[model samples]
Target: MDGERLFCDIALAARIERAEARLIAESSGAARARRGDSVGFARPFAGGVASFAEADSPFDKVAGLGFAGVPDAAELDEIERAFAELGAPVQIELCQLADAAVGAFLTGRGYRLESYENVLGRRVGDATFPDGVRYCRDDELETWLAEVADAFAVADTEGLPSHEEFPRGTVIDAMRDMAGVLRFVAERDGDFAGGASFRVTDGIAQFTGAATVPVHRRRGVQTALLRARLAVAAEAGCDIAVVTTQPGSKSQQNVQRQGFDLLYARAILVKGTSAISSSGADSRQAS
Candidate 1:
């Protein structure tokens, strides 16, 4: 397939995996909305809607407010209003086939496009393993969390959620709810170099939270982490695995080298002004 088609497939697969994870975590009431199907929609919180589909499906679960062809500008306004009312952020996914009007409508508003991540993937074809990288089911979760936090220190901080808002504890809790999380850590001379987490949902595994400490850059730790994770996913009966990385970033290059094809990119917009304003009130009260 061509580049765009490949990317779209990968992106859709990744979204399906995320939807499955949410379904697993939702309460019985929300799960009932699924109605024994691989696809369902739920309002996890007031004014916030989530749509999810199981793996191997082309349809997306509208987890937030950004799905493609959302009626018209009035509908968009309604969704945003609902999100604002609930003091929450809206999230959505659209395939590459989505019309240009879809993107234009979102940008026309003051949504402030934030992130564009390239979803990438490769088939579970051959079993090629990376050398010197140790794969294990058990991982040092706390240490890895700290390293991820440290890595984000250099990331753009203005108007973004603080570590406290989406803390390491929250991530651990989310991981616990997943079906299975395979962790691969690469160590050299008994020192931690880098690692990644593979979470499987409905036969599609997602690679999340991959990081290498600053001290271990250019040592092939990240590449090794990808290989080991993919192997595990393949063994787990997964037909495909997906990962998202910043466009043109090192991770993107590494994934490409490992035979993953890039999917379409999605913009990330943050409605942080309201969130920040609300947070300041709490801070003032505490102080």
Candidate 2:
């Protein structure tokens, strides 16, 4: 593999490890809440790790799964069958380093791919922010959402998904659910200019939804938002702040200018399924 591809592979492995750790933590919490014993990571003989958290019933909830070291077709088949039996839509993340046949296998099984993003990161350092910007926590969800919606209007273009269509509410809820969230916004002249949301985990703060208003573009709004978020992450003992963007997009250039390096690119595939029936009690809480 070339240097870039090698870098992507390394980054993918690290990301998978980080996600698995988070999954374990979440599963343990869920199990404890129900007063049930937690399940351990199950290593398939073929090569991959799978963990399931019981949801107060026999119905299995796939907490996390990842394949590495060139998994065989049988391994993929086993994974699909296991997840299908759970009666819930399973979420699987396949990095670019994954074997080409993996995508074909998933497609053959009616798994439609959706969404893509590039993971970016930078070490914490001194960053100058535009004057008058302020940082806030989850309390400012509505204000942050509004600024995000406006920024989306400016960032999106023809042939792309509109802000109305994207689930901004769901994103906000997810960020709130995750601990260590640091949300910030830049306001100038009593008007919102830019905003960003991030969560620190395992000493790495992942930055998401950083955007600037249309009229505020090129006015250092985004830069200020990023700088403020990074400072917050650093104060919280995070070693680095990571972000993702579309390849070759203006956002990518902006992040690069802010000293973030392109660690890797991964396609986010999302398949919509019909509503699932559940025998287990609805223990999952709404975000």
Model 2 stretches with alpha carbons more than 4 Å out: 1-13, 16-91, 98-115, 128-130, 137-139, 158-164, 270-287
Q: Write the per-residue lDDT of candidate 1 for residues 50-126, one digit (tens) a residue.
A: 42222211111233223333445665566566544544555444334345565566556655554444567776654
lDDT of 2 by residue, 128-234 (tens): 54476787655777777665654553443312221112234434333333334566778878887777767666777767557777777777777777777777776
TM-scores, each model vs. reference: 0.64, 0.63
Candidate with top lDDT is 2
Poorly placed runs, candidate 1 (over 4 Å): 1-82, 85-95, 99-101, 107-110, 135-139, 152-179, 270-287
Q: Rate the local accuracy (lDDT) of all candidates.
A: 0.50, 0.52
Cα deviation of 194 in candidate 2 (Å)? 1.8
Best by TM-score: 1
